[model samples]
Target: MIEIEGLSMDRDGVRVLDDVSLQIPDRSLTMLIGPNGAGKSTLLGLIARLLRPSAGHVRVDGLDVFRAASDAVARKLAILRQENHILPQLTVEELVGFGRYPHSRGRLAAEDRRQIADALHRANIAALAGRRLFELSGGQRQRAFLAMVLAQDTPYLLLDEPLNNLDPRQAISMMQVLRRAVTDLGKSIVMVVHDVNCASFYGDRIVAMNAGRLVAMGSPKDIVVPSTLRMIYGVDMSVHEVGGARIVQPFS
Candidate 1:
């Protein structure tokens, strides 16, 4: 379980996160949704230990995130940020191999190779393994980054707006991949998403944040209602059930 107590962050004297306390359970796919500057990315960064919280403590499975060794934390959780900067000349295989650094240190053993292959297969990027990073399109690059995170083989995966560059087809595929990871592999996946419909469709639990605070959190059925949508986004929309799934239509 991931626990945050009195979580708050300050940047240049501006409060990015308020006194927020939330308990995110394990073995579930949690979607974080909010408007711009709602602290969604900041919250993910804090949970991943990329940014230190000014006045709170973050714990993953009872281990204090800041107090634990970096290696220990890396083994438990892996993050895929929005921006990635690496040697453009590196092949996809090489980039994926870096994910095993926490386990292989420098030299990849037999098990490391097997894991790399599995990650590549999981992300549907095996055929492009020999291609350089710059050779792939934006969506493919996103999948490569996801493959790298999967290669890390951590129990918790944190993704920040992973669907930004994806087309509709690629976006659906990515969501299915994450769903498989949660259902088949039992990995805990947390992601920040902008599309409310996608979040409503795929998330086991939807967490809505606004103005640096958590406005609502519940199952898809609970969060996809008209009142909840208005409360979180200040927008009026109609919700319809299609084959047992709730879909929000914002425009008439």
Candidate 2:
């Protein structure tokens, strides 16, 4: 489990997050939803130890995330940020292999190779494995990055705006991949997403933030109502149940 206590961040005397406390349990997919600049990504960064909190603590299964050894924390949690810019010459497989560096220390063993191959297959990029990163489309490149994170084999995965540049079909496929990771592989996932319907359909729990504060958190059924939508997005929207899923339609 990931426990966050009194997390806060200030940049240039401007507060980004304030007294945020949250517990992310194991084997669940939690979607973070809010408007832009809501500090959703900032909170994820703090938990991943990419950013130091001004005053608070984040513990993953009892290890203080910010104080733990870098490799030790990397082994427990893997993060995929929104912008990943690498050498365009690297092939898909080679990039994914980088995820094993924490375990392999530059020399990949048999098990590392197997995990890389499995991640490639799971991300549906097995056919593109040999192609250069620049040769792939935006959506395919996103999948390649996701494959790298999967190959890391960490128990917790933190992704920021993972659905960016994905088509509708690709978005659904990615969410399904995450769902299987939770149900079958017992991984915990926390992601920032803009699509409310996608969060409603796939998230085991929804965490809503606004202006750097956590405003609401609950199951999709509990948080996908009209009032919550208005509270988060500042828009009036209609929510309807369709085929056991809640769909959000916002007004223009």
Candidate 3:
């Protein structure tokens, strides 16, 4: 389990993240949903130790994320932020190989090779392994980056808006891949997504935040209702049950 105790952040004298706390369970996909500037990504950064909070602590499986060794945290968790500025000339395989650095220390062993292969296969991008990133489509590049995160072979994975620039079909495919990762590989995944329908469909739990504060946290059925959607997004949306999953319909 991951425990976030009294986490807060300030940027240029403005509070970007208020005093917030949350507990993420193991082996489940939790979707963090909120409007732009709600501090969803900020919270993810804090948990991954990419950014230090003003005051509070993040503990993952009893390891103090802030004070632990960098390699130790890298071994325990992997994070993929939305924006990646890798050299476009790098081959997908080479990009994925970087994930093993913490364990391999720049020299990949047999286990590292196996992990990279497994990640490529699981991401359904084995065919693109040797292809340079510039030759791929937006969706393919996203998958390549995801493969890198998977290759890290961490128990916990955090992704920020992995579907950012993809088309609808691509987004669905990405969600399917994430579902498989959770069920087939038993990874605890926390993703920041804006599409509430996708969240309702794919998330085992939905955690809603607004203005840097947690507004609600529960199963899809509990958090995807009209009332909660209104409170979180300030838009009155109608929610229905379709195919045993809650679906939200936005009003114009």
Candidate 4:
């Protein structure tokens, strides 16, 4: 479980996240949703130790995330930010192998190779393993990066806007891959997503944030309701049940 207490952040003397506390249960896929500037990414950054909070603390399974040893934390959690700027000369296999750095420390063993292969297969990118990062399309690149994260084999995965550059089919496939990670591997995942329908369909829990504070957290059915949608997005939306999953339709 990830426990966040009194979490807050300030940028240039302006508050971004208030005193927010949350408990992310283990072995669950939680979706973080909110409007732009809602601090969803900031919160994930704090949890992943990419950014230090101005106040409060984040603990992953009882270890203080900010104070833990870098390698130890890396073993426990793996994060994939939205923007990745690495040398494009690296092949897909090489990029995925980087995830094993925590264990191999630049020297990959047989286990690392096996994990990398498994990650590529799970991400549906095995065929692109020899391709250079620059050669793939946006969706394919996203899958390659995701394969890297999966290769890390951490218990917790934090993804920020992972669907940023994917088409509809690619987006759905990505979500299904994540769902399998949670259900089959028992991984804890917290992802920031803008699409409510995807969250409703794949997420076990939905966490709503607004103006840098958590407004609500519940199952998809509870969070996708009309009132909750209006409160979070400031827009009226209609919710419908389709094939046992909640779907939200926004009206202009």
Candidate 5:
């Protein structure tokens, strides 16, 4: 479980997060949803230890994330930010291999090789392994990066708006891959999603944030109601159920 207590972030005297507290249960898929500038990404950075919170604490399974050693935290959690800048000349395989550095220490062993292969397969990018990042399309590059995160083989995974430039098919495929990771491998996946429909379909739990604070949290059915949607996005939306999954129709 991840426990966030009184989390607040400040930048240049501007408060981005305000006394935010959350508890993310283990082995569950939680989706964070909010409008722009709601501090979702800032909170994610704090949880991943990418940035130090000005106040509060983040504990991953009782281990203080900020106080823990870098290697120890890396072993337990993996994070993929939305904006990642990598060398354009690097091959997908080489990029994925970097994920093993916590364990391999720059020298990949047999286990690392196996993990790399598994991650490529899981992300459906096995054929793109040898291709240079610049040679691939936008969606393909996203898949390659996702493969790198998967190769980390951590129990907790945090992804920030991973569907940024993906096409519809690629987005669906990625969500399915995440579902497999949770159901088959028992991984805890927390992702920030812009598409309410995508979060409705894939998330076991939906957390809504607005103005740098958590506003609502529940199952999709509970959080996707008309009132909740209006409260969070300040827009009236229609809700539909198809094949037991809730979908939000924001544009009518």
Candidate 6:
């Protein structure tokens, strides 16, 4: 389990994250949802130790995430950020191979090769393994990056707006892939997503934030209610049950 206490962050005197405390359980997909500037990404970064909190403690699996060795943290979790400065010349396979750096140390062994192959397959990008990143579409590139993170084989994965630049079909595909990662691969995922309906259908839990604080966190049933949607997004939404999943329909 991941435990957080009194977490806060301030940048240039603007408190982007307030005193937030929550526990994120393991082996499930947790979706972070909120309006822009709600600090969803900030919390994700803090958990990955990419951004240090002004105050608080984060412990993952009983290890201090903020104080642990960098290598140890890398091994324990992997985070895919919003922007990446990638060498566009690198092939998809090469990009995925980078995830093994924690285990391979720049030289890939047979086991590393096996992992790379598995990640490519899991990400549904094996056929594109030989293709350079610059040659793929935005959605394909996103999956390539996901494959890299998967190749790391960490128990925890954090993603920021991972559905960026994808069509509806592609986004659903990505969610399906992520769900499998949680169930089949035994990964615990926390992702910042704008699509509440997608979160409702796929997330094991939904974490809602607003103005830099957590407004609510619970199963879709707890959060997909009209009142909760109003509190988080300040919008009128009617939630419906479709095929056993609650779908949030927003209208003025």
**Per-residue accuracy of model 2 over 76-141 as CA lDDT, tens digit each:** 999999789898999999999999999999999999999999999988899999999999999899
The RMSD of every model to the true structure, in order and in angstroms, is 1.2, 1.0, 1.4, 1.1, 1.0, 1.3
Candidate 4 residue pairs in clash (backbone atoms < 3 Å) = none
**Which residue pairs in candidate 6 have backbone atoms (N, alpha carbon, C) closer than 3 angstroms, thus clashing?**
none
- Could you give candidate 5's per-residue lDDT for residues 169-223 as a string of tens digits? 8888889989989999999999999899989989999999998899999999999
Lowest-lDDT window of 10 residues in candidate 1? 164-173
After superposition, candidate 6 runs with Cα above 4 Å error: none
Off by over 4 Å in 1: none
Per-candidate TM equals 0.96, 0.97, 0.95, 0.97, 0.98, 0.95
Candidate 2, lDDT over the whole model: 0.93
TM-score result, candidate 3: 0.95
lDDT of each candidate versus the true structure: 0.91, 0.93, 0.91, 0.93, 0.93, 0.91
Candidate 5: lDDT of 140? 88
- Candidate 6 lDDT over residue span 1-252, tens digit each: 889899999988999999999999999999999999999889989989999999999998888999999999999999998887899999999999999999999999999999999889877789999999999998889889988998999899999988888788878777888899899878899998888898899999999999889999999989999999999999889989999999987754
Per-prediction tally of clashes: 0, 0, 0, 0, 0, 0
> Per-residue lDDT for 153 in model 1?
92
| Model 5 Cα shift for residue 65 (angstroms) | 0.8
Q: Compared with the true structure, what per-residue lDDT tens digits does model 4 show for residues 1-252?
A: 999999999989989999999999999999999999999989999999999999999999898999999999999999999789988999999999999999899999999999999999977889999999999998889889999999999999999988888888878888888898899989999999999998999999999999999999999988999999999999998899999999988755
Runs of candidate 4 with Cα error greater than 4 angstroms are none
Candidate 2 — which residues are off by over 4 angstroms?
Answer: none
* Stretches of candidate 5 exceeding 4 Å from the true structure: none
